[model samples]
Target: MTPHNELRLLPWSGPDGKPCFLSTDNTNGHLSRLADNTEAIQLDLATELLDYASVLLNGAETDSEELRALATDLTEALRDTLRVAESRGHRLPPPHTDTHADDTDSPTLPAAAFG
Candidate 1:
């Protein structure tokens, strides 16, 4: 039997927005179930966000508040999805590099590079 100190993925953030890991060895324990439920809710929220976006787009007019709320929901859902991916052992790719650019030279449009 495994000990209770085994680390398990957290379902949500703590009071200060940090991930909270639970130390438990049971595969079917309460914390494990909670994590699974959280992951499912996150994925479902993402799907709901897409549906809401489509509805908003189809409407004749949209208020700024509605748009802002949608954006917030989208961001939270994305973060949750990323957490799920991390728990599954997936990682983000390295930042893209410009092979033509030199190491010592600064980017051409430093102030407006992103655009």
Candidate 2:
């Protein structure tokens, strides 16, 4: 069994909207593969939605009703994408840091880099 902190965060929620986790040493296990496939599908759908949104927003005759629906879909996609990101992030190895270096010595990106 893996340590509590090292458990894999599954891509979906449990009953009553609680988070679900998996603990296994095998990377190619059944649940791991399922999570991987689900994440891929979610990301692909989000990408498709983004393209559709761009086209819809650029149209002159787009109606308020359609925009509201699009907003709802986008919100759901964003939520799923965030969950997938959190799950995968937990599975990544920890970053290495130098003990001799001060926090101020660390590199930083400009604000524009985020955009």
Candidate 3:
């Protein structure tokens, strides 16, 4: 696990390995922000941020408590920023999801080929 400050400098990647911003400052930034507030809302926000970081780090094959916390905080900030942008008419592309062609609708191969 990192000391939390260094974790902020780490980059977060989406499921598609694209970059995403998580915090305005390094891990220290997140710590500093949290230090100023201890409300339930802030704690909840922290949890949400941590969850996002876990997903990002897991996608990039990295995991740690500090990384997770930092990532989560960054993720929350990103989400809020996006929400504000959307409210103002800025749109973001949705996260990528695997969409398989309808193989069930395609003609099936002959079963006799295996026999």
Rank all candidate structures by their TM-score, best first, as comma-separated numbers: 2, 1, 3
Best of the candidates, TM-score: 2
Report how far off residue 98 is in candidate 2 (Å): 4.1
Error of 3 at 59 (Å): 21
- For every model shown, the clashing-pair count is 0, 0, 4
How do the residues 1-115 of candidate 1 rate in per-residue lDDT, one tens digit apiece? 4432356557588899887887655768887888888889889989988898999979989999999998998898888888887765422334456654466434356666676
Error of 1 at 69 (Å): 1.0
Candidate 3 local accuracy as lDDT?
Answer: 0.48
* Candidate 1's TM-score: 0.65
* lDDT rank order: 2, 1, 3
Give the Cα lDDT of each candidate.
Answer: 0.75, 0.85, 0.48
**Off by more than 4 A, model 1:** 1-6, 90-115
As for TM-score, the candidate ahead, 1 or 2, is 2
Clashing pairs in 2: none
Worst 10 residues of 2 by lDDT: 96-105
How well does model 2 score by local distance difference test?
A: 0.85
Q: Considering summed lDDT, which 10 consecutive residues are worst modelled in model 3?
A: 1-10
- The root-mean-square deviation over C-alpha atoms between each candidate and the true structure, in angstroms, is 10.4, 5.8, 18.1
